[model samples]
Target: MLSWALTFLIIAIIAAVFGFGGIAGAAAGIAKIIFFIFVVLLVISLVANAVKGKAPKV
Candidate 1:
């Protein structure tokens, strides 16, 4: 999930360097959405682990 966002971000950067405005914008948008989803899931996982009284595995 986070990797996917990073991949999209890289793609956006590359596209922008090549002057692909539409592609860059679309990829950047997708990256942002994926990043937020990853953040939400991470928070939820942490809360679940805390509720179970288990430390998150390192």
Candidate 2:
């Protein structure tokens, strides 16, 4: 999911460089949303692991 956000971010930068305003804006928006979702899921996973009293595997 984080990879997906990075991909979209790259796409947005490329689109913006090519003067595709609409596509750039849309891709950037999607990237932001995906990034936030990823962060939320990561926090939830960390909390769950902590509550389970298990150390995260390296």
Candidate 3:
């Protein structure tokens, strides 16, 4: 998910450099959404792990 956000960020930068305002804006927006989702999921997972006391078996 983070990689996807980075991919879209690169796409947005390239599109902006090429003067594609619409595509750049869209890609930037998507990157932001992806980044937010990644953060939220990470936080959720951390909280869940904190509540979960036992370690998993190998």
Residue 45, candidate 3: alpha-carbon lDDT:
97
- Candidate 2 residue 43 C-alpha distance from true site, Å: 0.2
How much is 7 displaced in model 1, in angstroms?
0.2
Cα deviation at 32, candidate 3, in Å, is 0.3
Candidate 2 ranges beyond 4 A from true positions: 54-58
Per-residue alpha-carbon lDDT of model 3 for 1-58, expressed as tens digits?
Answer: 9999999999999999999999999999999999999999999999999998698899
What overall lDDT, based on C-alpha atoms, would model 2 receive against the true structure? 0.99
Error of 2 at 42 (Å): 0.1
User: Which segments of model 1 are wrong by more than 4 Å?
Assistant: 54-58
Candidate no. 3 TM-score: 0.90
TM-score list, all predictions = 0.91, 0.91, 0.90
Over 4 Å off, model 3: 55-58
Candidate 2 residue-wise lDDT at 12: 100
Residue 1's lDDT within candidate 1 is 98
Residues forming the 10-long window of minimal summed lDDT in candidate 2: 47-56
